[model samples]
Structures are given as C-alpha cells and as structure tokens.
Target: MEIREDDLTGQQIIALLREHLENMHEITPPGSVHALDLERLRSREITFWTAWEGDDLLGCGALKELDPTSGEIKSMRTPAAHRRRGIASKLLEHIIEVARQRGYTHLYLETGAFPAFAPARALYQRYGFEYRGPFGDYADDPNSTFMVKTLVG
Candidate 1:
C-alpha cells in the first residue's frame, strides 16, 4: 500500500473524512466526541495522510501536534470494503513512523469507549499505547478512553 500526504481537498480523502465524522457521531456520545472538523484539518495543526492500493483509497489517518514532544492521532478510518484487511493498522503504523521522523516522542489518542470502538482500542494496545489521563483540551469523559505510546526514535 502507498502511504502519502493528503491535502484534505481531494474528493476521495474528503469523502473518507466525512465518513469518519459520520461514524464518530453515530457511535460516540455527542458531548464526548472530539473529532476535528474540516477547517481544523485544513489548518497547520494536523498532518493528514491517505493510504492507497493503486487507485483504491484504502484508508487514512492523521497526527496532530499537541506539543513539542507529543502528538495526537485523529481522523483514522478505513473504507468499508477494506476493513479487516490490515489497512488501518498499516495506516496507523505509518502515522507513528511519521511522528517519530518529525521528532515527536509520544503519541496520544482518544477513542470511544463503546463496543464499536473495541477493535481500535485493541489495535492501539498492540502498538504499545497505555491508558492515560486526559491531556490537552480533553477532560475525563465516560464515553472516551485516552491512551498514549512513547516513541523510541
């Protein structure tokens, strides 16, 4: 799979992001959801990427700078046809590598605590992320689980 930077304006990337927003809204309780909006993504706070297999948009994920030593994962999603094919894992690994190359020493993420988010939480755990208290603009919320992974590079 090809992993590359996304400008947030590409039709396929935009549609995939919209899908992520829709899914987050459907699965996460309204008051606890923290997915970024299009405008924020278009800004410099985030670095976004799309994963592709030839012309097929397999998945996408983003890393946002929360500070000099750490970042947050955002907008991770895999197309319906591509789920369970290791696309999200590949995208996530790419994001982690990118963060390390960019000098980030830690990566944090907030995902739903619901059953639908089980696979995602498990994936993060496999990558060595440990549960953590809320950071940045986040607070303790019953609907969200916060996690972090320290980078060795």
Candidate 2:
C-alpha cells in the first residue's frame, strides 16, 4: 500500500472522513465525540495521510501538532472492508515516525471508552501508549479514554 500526505480534497477521502464522523457519533456520546470535522482536520496544525492500494483507498490518519514538543493523533480509520489488513497500523507507525522527526517528545490521543472502541484502544496500547488523564483542552469524561506515549530517541 502507498501511504502519503493527503490534501483532503478527494471525494474518496471526504467520503471516508464523513463515514468516520458518522461512526464516531453513532458509538460515542455527543459531547465525548472528539473527532474533528473536515474543516478542523484542514487546519494548519494538522497533517493528514491516506493509505491506498492502486485505485483503492484503504484508510487514513492524521497528526496534529499540539505544541512544540507534543502532538495528537487524529482521524485514524480503516474501512470495514479493509479491516485487519495492517492499514491502520501502517498509518499509525507513519504518524509516530513523523512525530519523532518533528522532535515531538510525546504523542497523545483520545478515543471512545465504549466497548466498540476496544480494538482501537488495543492498537494504541500495542504501540506503547499508556492510559493517561485528560490533556490539552480535554476534561475528565467517562466516555473518553485518553492515552499518551513518551517518545524516546
């Protein structure tokens, strides 16, 4: 699969992101759904990427620079048809490497606390992220699970 920076203008990506938001809303509570919309993801602080296999769009993820030494992972999703194909893992590894390259000392993310999010939580755990209290603008919410990873050189 080819993974590269995306401009978020393609129909496929727009559709995928829409689906991502819809899924988030379906599974997460209204206030606890922290997933960004298309406009938010287009902000200057964020870098988005998509995974592709020829004409097929496999998945997408993004890294958002929170400060000089920290970043947040966002919009990580793989279509149902493409699950368990390592697309999410590849995108995650890519984001982590980019964060390291940018001199970020920590990577943070917030996901749902529901059972529907167990797989996602497991994936982050496998990548060395540990459960943490809320960070950034986040508050303590039972519907949210916050995690952070200390980047070591």
Candidate 3:
C-alpha cells in the first residue's frame, strides 16, 4: 500500500470524506460531532493524505497543526470494504511520523465515546496514545474522548 499527501481533488477522496462526515453524524450527538468537512480539511493548517493500493483507495487521515509544537489528528477513515486490513493503522503511523518530522512535540485527537468508536480508541492506545482531558478549543464533553501522544522527549 502507498500512503502519500493528497490535495483532496480526486472524486474518490471527496466521496470518502463525505462518508466520514456522514458516519460521524450518525454516531455522535448533534453538538458533539467534530469531523471536519471538506472545506475545513482543506484549510491551510491541515495536511491530508490517502492510503492507496495500486489504484484502489484504502483509507485517509490528516494532521492539523494546532501550533508549532502540536497537532490534532483529523478525518481518519477506512472504508467498510477496507476495514480490518490495517489500513487505518498504516495511515495513523504515517501521520504520526509526519508530525514528528514537522517538529511537533505532541499529537492529540478527539474521537467518539460511543461503542462504535471502541476500535479506533484501541488503535490509538496501541500506538502509545493515552487518554487525556480536552485540549485546544474543546471543552468538557461526555460524548468525546480525548487522547494524546508525545512525539518528542
């Protein structure tokens, strides 16, 4: 599988992002859904990437610079057909590596607190992320689970 920076111009990427938005809305409460829309993902602060196998898109993830030394993981999605094949894991690894390369001292992400988000929480935990309280513009929200990983000593 190949993971590379994406400009989010492809139809496939757009569709996948749309699906991600839909899924987030379906699972999270109205005020708690934090998934970035296409416009938000394209912001200057965010770097987006997609995982591909030959011509097939496996998944996508993004790193959003919250400040010079920190970032927030966003828009991580692996289509249902590509689930359980380590696609999301690979994408997450790539995002973390890129964050380190960019001199980010830390990375944080907020995911749903629902059962549907268990697998994702597990994936982050496996990668050394620990549960944390809300950061950035986020406040206390029972529907969200915040996690963090230090990228620098």
Ranking by TM-score: 2, 3, 1
What's the TM for model 2? 0.98
Estimated TM-score for each candidate:
0.95, 0.98, 0.98
The top-ranked prediction according to lDDT is: 2
User: Given candidate 3, what's the lDDT at residue 40?
Assistant: 90
Cα-lDDT of candidate 3: 0.95
| TM-score, candidate number 1 | 0.95
Off by over 4 Å in 1: none
- Give the range where candidate 1 is weakest over 10 consecutive residues by summed lDDT: 36-45
Candidate 3 TM-score versus the reference: 0.98
lDDT of each: 0.89, 0.96, 0.95
lDDT of 2 at 130: 98
What digit string (tens of lDDT, one per residue) describes model 2 on residues 1-153?
999999999999999999999999988878889999999999999999999999999999999999999999999999999999888999999999999999999999999999999999999999999999999999999999999999975
Kindly report which residue stretches of model 3 are placed more than 4 angstroms away from their true locations once superposed. none
Tens-digit per-residue lDDT, 1-153, candidate 1 = 899998888888888888888888888877987988788887787898889889889998889999888899998889889999998899899989988988888999999889989999999999999999898989899899999999973
**Number of clashing residue pairs in every model?**
0, 0, 0
